[model samples]
Target: MGEFEFLAKLRERLPPDGPQVKLGSGDDAAVTAPAGATATSVDAIVEGVHFRRGEAELRTVGRKALATALSDLAAMGAEAGEAYVVLGAPADLGEEDFLALLDGMLELAAETGTTIAGGDVTRAPALTLAVTVVGHAAAADAFVTRAGAQPGDLLVLTGEIGAAAAGRLLLEHPALAAELPESTARELRRRQLDPMPRLRTGLALAGSGATAMIDLSDGLAADAGHLARAGGVALQIQADSLPLAAGVAEVAAAAGRDPIELAVAGGEDYELLAALPPDRLVPASDASGEAGEAKLTPIGEVVVGEGVEIRLPRGGQLKAAGFDHFAGPERGSQPEARERRGG
Candidate 1:
């Protein structure tokens, strides 16, 4: 389909616009009003790097593009407002496939109460979608920042981690996943392809006195370091306490890798990790979060020192690392660095 035809289908799936969106899709430019504080975030997905062109389903790709961009809004504890997707697609891409892809994004957009506004559509060597989301806060202090964490604050994580990375590994080498149970494979793939943004949990934490917050886009340990450096506090993550997702351990074992290591280094979980006062330990949605279940849990504590440390249950420290785009490899202290620190 042509650009205009594709956008028309996308607009149909979008949630009905509120007062904030004076104009929806199909305009020279979209207009919006800020009822309160607003958070705007832009994210893009490139072919090969973000998704496999022909191998990955188009709908799944669409959902991921929008889901990833909205995750930033969730991190800020903001409610959905409206969105615009700039498409860099090839001319050879058929209308049906493109529409299907956009429909995927619209489904998630409706789920999050966001409408698709407007954006540019142009030709590119490969398919790419850049999404911009605008979100609004409900009340004062409803927006959380990384700098809000305190030395005494406890670090709480929302939802599961590691499954996405395992899924990625399996996708790269399906032979590895073939050894695992079918259900395990499906769950792991879902983690990578259909990650849900922590919207409700983020809002809940923002209202409940979460000191600092960041979405886990770059794996646990990497993002933990981000929160630590931003808040000027050290984080001590208990390796045993993490809420590892279902199939993560099984998949890790199949790949001859450590489950905890995967949980720490696997990126793209799209979960939220926040520093909270000791009292606000659990969000209402995850109030019944039980052991061996993927739910909110307190995995660490904020400390006065610098850098991050994973307190292994077995008694040794694993210097934490995560994906860094420019750095090639994630920067972290080797085990020897732990001894240097007098561990």
Candidate 2:
């Protein structure tokens, strides 16, 4: 199909526009009316660098491309509004594959109550998806940022970690799944392929007096560093206090890697991490469970220092590798692209 023909197909399949959107899709620019404030973020995933098309369904890839981008808005405690997608399709992509990809994003957009407002399509050497998302809030101050953390604030994380990293390991070395239960193995892979953004949890925390917040996209250790640096305070995370996904230890052990390291440095959990006042813990936890079905775990504290320190239970510091997009290749880093290879 031609580009315009494909776009027409997309318009037919897209969900109805959200409340904020005045004009959506098939226009030179999308029209949105906002009452207060807006938060925007963009993310892109490539065929080999971010995912292997051979291993993942086109629908899953579409979901992930949109999910990860929305995660940034979630960190800011913004309500999902609308999405603009830029899709680069290689010549070989069939019509069914293209629609499959769009269907995935449509599914997630409907679930999040977000509208697919507008986007552009083009030819490329690889399958590429870039998503721009805008979220809504009552006011600018109503949304949380990483710089708002204060000393003596408690550090809390929504949902567990290390599952995506373990999932990556299983994908790279399928033999590791032998020791884990079938369901556990399936869940680990799902965590890597279809991570859910903690949107409701973020909204609850923001309303519950959260001072600072971020999504765990680049692993806890690296993302915590970002939070600490932005807030100009030190973070002391207890190694033993981290909530690991059910099969992380098994997958890590079978792969001859440290479970804690995987949990700390394994990227793409897509969970929210926030700094909260001590008094807000109960309300935050209660609200988070009620809104998102996620439990808030107090993992650490902000202190009068700089950088992040992961304190081991036995009185030592644990070193973990963190994902960096522009850095040189390193083991356990760049979970999204660690196993990247051309099709």
Alpha-carbon RMSD, each predicted model? 5.1, 2.2
Clashing pairs in 1: 1-95
lDDT of 1 by residue, 203-293 (tens): 7777777888898877788889899999888999999998888888877888787888877877889888888888777543344242222
Q: Give all candidates' CA lDDT scores.
A: 0.78, 0.89
Candidate 1: residue 203 lDDT (0-100): 74
* Candidate 2: pairs in clash: none
* Candidate 2, run of 10 with poorest lDDT: 334-343
Model 2's TM-score against the true structure: 0.96
Task: Find the candidate with the highest TM-score and give its number.
Answer: 2
Best of the candidates, lDDT? 2
What candidate 2 gets wrong by more than 4 Å, as runs, is: 330-343
Clashing residue pairs in all predictions, respectively, total: 1, 0
